[model samples]
Target chain A: MKLTCTVNGLRIEATAEPRLLLVDFLRHQLRLTATHVGCEIGVCGACTVIVDDEPVRSCLMLAVQADGCRIETAESLAAGGELSPMQASLHAHHGLQCGFCTPGILMTLEALARSGQLPGDEDGVRHVLGGHVCRCTGYQHIVDAVLAQAR
Target chain B: MKPPSFAYARPGTVAEAAGLLAQGDGAVLLAGGQSLMPMLNLRLAAPDTVIDINGIAGLADVRRDDGRLRIGAMARQAALMRTPAVGEALPLLALALPHIGHPQTRSRGTIGGSLCHADPAAELALVAVAADAVLTLLSSAGTRTVPARAFFLHAMETVRAADEILTEITFPASRPGARCAFRELARRHGDFAIAAVAAEWSPEGLTIAVGGLEATPRVCAHLSRELAGRPFEQAAVVRLIDEELAQTEPLEDGVIGPDYRLQLARVLLNDCLAEVLPP
Candidate 1:
């Protein structure tokens, strides 16, 4: 299937099988490797990306389904070659170690920030972080990073 | 890790979607795909044709109609959480919405998809059974409405025919002085519940529904009848729930045993009752 979508401000037109997941379309076809694939079954949250301003599991969505949608990946964060505010904050807080799940977490928080739904406090940030499983940092640093952004 | 390849069709209307489903070539309707996608990736479901219903018009609407809340089947859980009609009119559903999944999943998971997926522990299914919502099923032939209670046949099963698509679910609009509480016990905040309970009390009566107990959300029908429109002590209610639950077989999963599930349900039921039936 021929798929077309705007990704990280780039117009992408690619051909993929109907079963090709959006995460693969970005990582493999579009060469946007910042979006990592953890558990393809949607539990790991490493596949999170913003589609049409909403954070969704890209692996759970087929590339064909994302046609005509506006998508944002973690690559969009540091597109300017300088760390985005959230990314910089994550770094300052040591929010990531292995960083396999960092991209998805960043995109999830980006979606929340874009929608002006970023929680006002640490607990609220932790609540939103409940969706993403971070094994490396124990989520304390991640929560601190997101809270720093909110402040 | 990858879904099996299949022909994909994006139907512009429900009728076309139903027609594709009626073809009997192993067609499956793709709604939010939060549940189905995982199954597809895991090779649990391999359909010959995947009918994408996201393009269908008016399937994502939420509105109040004639003293009832008419929610389109495609109404995403996140959309419902933000919808004023849902929050103002369907308190039980509103209470259960946040527990469905994480924000990312809820942003794409549809209410209709949740009910149709019909997991015994799905929060939406529990809300539907608790609130006595009515569901509208559409097929190539025609449309028929079924009360939520009659919709579920068993775990991950429903009376919905293979060719039919659930189009809408109508929940009773909120009544004045209606108090509701929803509680779920899960390993994580967004994980599937091991035991969950929803309680609603209005002038009309008290309705109790529990999930993760049996093949479907179990409406404490007998207990509801016993407590409806009447005031009762907490001890009496607890004893009643205990007796009712003791007679039934609780669902047991690898996460916990049936005995523990029953125990959790008992505690949750008590907590929910305490919230709405405060002393």
Candidate 2:
């Protein structure tokens, strides 16, 4: 199947298998590997990405289904070789250790911030972070990083 | 794991989708893909044909129609939270929506997809039963409306025919002064409820529905009627609910026991009823 979508302001036109997940297409076809695939199921948010301004599980969506949609991945965060504010905050706060779950969290927060839905407090940030699973850092630093950007 | 390769059809119309469903040996409708995609990746479902209905028009509408809150089957859970009509007319459903899944899943999970999935612990299906919502199903032959209670046959099973598509669900507008409450207990936030209860109080009567303890949510009809317009007696209502729950065999899985589910049901029902009923 032909998959066409705008990724990080770049028009991507490629042929992919009908069953190819959007996460796979973004990583393999586009070679934009920031989006990590943790659990192939939607349980893990490591495959999160922005589709048409809303954060969605890339693993849960087929590349064909994303045709013509505007997709934003973690690769879009640091375009000018400089850390984006969220990335900077995460780094300053030591939000990530193993970094397997960082890309999805960053993309999730990116969509929330873009939509003006970022929570202002720690509890609210933690609530949104519930969707993500991180074995390292115990989410304390992640909450700090998100709270820093949220305010 | 990845989904098995299969023929994919993005139908432009419900009729076309229904035709694909009717013709294909193993055709499945793809709505939000929040649930279906996971099942497919896990190889739990292997449809020969995947009918992508996301391209169909007018399937995501949420509006008030003829004094009823008519929600299209493809209405995303996150979108429903933003919809004024849903919050204004169906507060119970609005309250339960947050518990369906995380905001990430809710962004793409459709109410119709959840109902069609027919998970016993699904918050939307529990609210559907509690509100007595009417579901409209479409097929190549015609359309039919079934009450939510009758739509769910068992866990992950429904009366919907293979060729039928659930198009919309119509919930009667809440009456003035109607009070409703929803409560669910899950291991974690956004997890499937171990036991959940939805209760509504109105001048006409009372409706209470409990889920996660059985293959389908159990509507406490007689108990609801008995307690209508009466001051809530905690002990008496608890006893009544206990008696009612005793009749239906509770579902027991490896993690949770049947007795624990029944206990959770009792507590949740009491908690929700206390909020809506007169003290």
Candidate 3:
């Protein structure tokens, strides 16, 4: 099947099997490897990405299913050469170590930020960051970084 | 893991979608795909054809008229949370919406999909049965409305024929002064419940449903009738729930044993009743 979608800011046209997952299409076909696929059943947020500005489990969506949608991967954050505000904040707050899940977390928070739902405080940030599991950084720095962006 | 290869079709109208479904060569309707996609990836389901109905027109609106709330099947669960009308007019939905997976999953999970999926532990399924909602099912043949109790046949099964699609659901509005409450006990904030309960209570009567207990959400019809005339004493209600649990064969999900579920169901029933019923 031929899949056409807007990714990051570019229009992409690619051929894929009907069963190809959106995450694989981005990582393998589009060469956008930032969106990791972990716990492929949609429980983990490692596959999270923005589809039409809404955060979704890319592992749970097919490339064919997203034929005409707008998608944003973690690569979009650094598309301009310099770190985006969120990327910089995550670094400053020490929000990552062995960052396999960073891209998905970043995209999830990015969607929240886009929606103006970034929490103003630590607890509020944790509340909104539910369902995302972070095995590293103890989540405190992630909350701190998210708070910085929220402010 | 990737899903097995399949043919896909995006129909622009429900009639076209139904027509395609009526063709039925191992065809499965794809709505939000939050649940179905995972199953596909796991190869638990591999329909030869996936009929994508998200493109279908007139299946994503929510409206209120004639003492009921009509929610189109394709409307996302997150959309329901954002709708002030749902929160203001439907206490049961407002209470249950936040518990259907996390906000992220809710963004793409549709109400119809969840209800049609009919997981025994699904909040929407249990809530609809407790509320006695009605569903509009369509196919190339025509349309039929199935009440919530009749809609769910068993765990992960519904009365919906292989060729039919559930298009809309009408939830009867709660009567004035009615107290509606929902509670679920899960391992985490968004995990499937170990035990869950929903209740609609008023001076007139009681309607209650318990999830994670049986093959389907168990509406305590006998207990609801008993509570209609029974006093609001916590002890009495607890005893009544225990009596009902005695007759039920709770389904064990490996997470908890049936005995634990019965106790948990009793605990949830108490908590839910405390919120809606007088001391």
Which RMSD values do the candidates have, in order? Answer: 1.1, 1.0, 1.6
Please report how far candidate 1 places residue B92 from its true position, in Å. 1.0
Task: Provide the DockQ value for model 3.
Answer: 0.75
- lDDT per residue (tens digit) for residues A1-151 in model 1: 8888899888888888999999998999888898999889888899899999999999999999988999999888887699999999999999999999999999999999988999979878988899898888999999988998898
- Find the candidate with the highest lDDT and give its number: 2
What is the per-residue lDDT of model 1 for residues B115-207, given as tens digits with 9 covering 90 to 100? 999999999999999998999999989999999999999889999999999999999887889999999999888988999999998778888
Task: Name the TM-score of candidate 1.
Answer: 0.98
Off by over 4 Å in 2: none
Stretches off by above 4 angstroms in model 1 are none
lDDT of 2 by residue, A24-85 (tens): 99999889999999998898799999999988999999999999899999998999999999
Q: Is candidate 1 or candidate 2 better by lDDT?
A: 2
Worst 10 residues of 2 chain A by lDDT: A142-151
Question: Each model's interface RMSD (Å)?
Answer: 0.7, 0.6, 1.2
As a whole number from 0 to 100, the lDDT of residue A76 in candidate 1 is 87
Instruction: Candidate 2: give the TM-score of chain A.
Output: 0.97
Q: DockQ of every model listed?
A: 0.91, 0.89, 0.75
lDDT of candidate 2 over B1-279, digit per residue (tens):
999988899999999999888894689999999889999999999999999999999999998887799999999999999898888999999899988888889999999999999999999999999899999999999999999989999999999999999999999988889998999999988888999999889877899999998999889887797889888898888888877887878998889999999889989988888899888
lDDT of 3 by residue, B16-134 (tens): 99999999669998999989998998999989999999888789899998888999999999889889878766889889998888766887899999998988889999888898999
